[model samples]
Target: MATFTEHYDLIKPGTDDYYDVADFNENMDAIDTQLYQAEQDMAGVSEKIGNPGDEGEDTLFGLLNPGNQPEEKADFYRYSKTEIKKQIQNWKPNLSGSTTFYGKITTFRAEKNGTVYVKWTSSDTANGEFYIYHKAPLSILEAPDQSELGSSIPKGLQQEDFCYYHINYVYSSNKGKPTTFEWVFPVIAGIDYTFMWYASSASSLYLNEFSLGYTDTKEA
Candidate 1:
């Protein structure tokens, strides 16, 4: 008579039965197959679970914080407090332009949607008005119908048909004194904007400096 183990069914010799090499080989073969299958299952799990030091996609270390994740896929990853402070401290002006009243008008446009800053210094003998207008895109306004909308909406308009009057400043400066002015506004990507420096008296209106810049954060 012969008996067997409960789990793997390994052979256990009864008092009357003698040891057999065939039974030993069969048990070893069964154990080898189970070990191979276990190794494969562990490997597949390890790939998804990932190691502690692993970085980037498909790794536990690369997983973003559940509370800090972005709402949109296209949005940038949320940064830590230190990283955000570093970005703000490293903020620099991207674009700049200078022009005098006598020089050609200066225009600015941003490549990305962000906050724009315009700054200038001017010296005047009398009073004058400075204007910064955001030129509207061609698609901003639709063609008007003569039957419904009257003179308020004109037809046959070109791309430069409309502009948003952004900044209107009236200042009185003494002779040989320079006054500085700056404005922060929102800008759309790829739209052109221009500023005008007008003087009530042309005798001594000097635009010393003019600059345009943008930043990702609105605080700029």
Candidate 2:
């Protein structure tokens, strides 16, 4: 059968042409050779540390190591600044349909459709429930065009080229009652989002930790 690459080829190769799609698994030795070559060709760097002699602290490179930072970044959301951290915390949003007396709300992310759904499981049904009102951007319906975007976009966020979203959340417990609360937020355009929730015992609800993320549709 013709392979996926063959189907995608702009100009079909003549039957005589040779093609190899080993998937890098047919020969373990060849795979090992490639790995060795990469290790040999990669670069090495030596840098200074913040507190060089003190074993208590970490080096600059150590801080920048893989998995150490967020995949989606913003000049406005840098962890290095107290103000930035505060801003991100402030921007945290929530979308759960329920609330709690402790003032914490659940969060849900539904990718395909504009509707957001949540599954709440709690032993306390009455006091454990919360109410949520969804708030989202207008374009959660607007498709962001990746083809027209410039290079200024971040790595993970480019997927949102066509996705948009809004946010809303609340958490007000019912006092000693435990129950699951599920709410669906109305959405149009899909988007990358950061959701935050706080416990709302009274009419005023405070913000707590947030969920930050991004999502995109398949390229056309």
Question: Quick one: best TM-score, which candidate?
Answer: 1
Candidate 1, residue 203: how far the Cα is off, in Å: 2.5
- Candidate with best lDDT: 1
CA lDDT of each candidate?
0.48, 0.32
For each candidate, give its TM-score against the true structure: 0.39, 0.21
Against the true structure, candidate 1 reaches a TM-score of: 0.39
Candidate 1, residues 1-220, lDDT tens digits: the string is: 8788888887777788888899889989888998999999999887877764445557554554322344442122221111111001111111112111211134555577766665556665545554444653333222221112221222222234444453444445567577777555677888765544444433454555665666332332
| Whole-model lDDT, model 1 | 0.48
Model 1: per-residue Cα lDDT at residue 131: 46
Off by over 4 Å in 2: 1-110, 121-173, 200-220
| Model 2 lDDT per residue over 1-220, tens place | 3332332233333466565444324444555776787676553223344432333326654455333434443221332221111121221222244333322232233354433433333322131223332333333213231112121322233353332332232234443333333333443444333232223233222232222222221110
- Residue pairs in clash, model 1: none
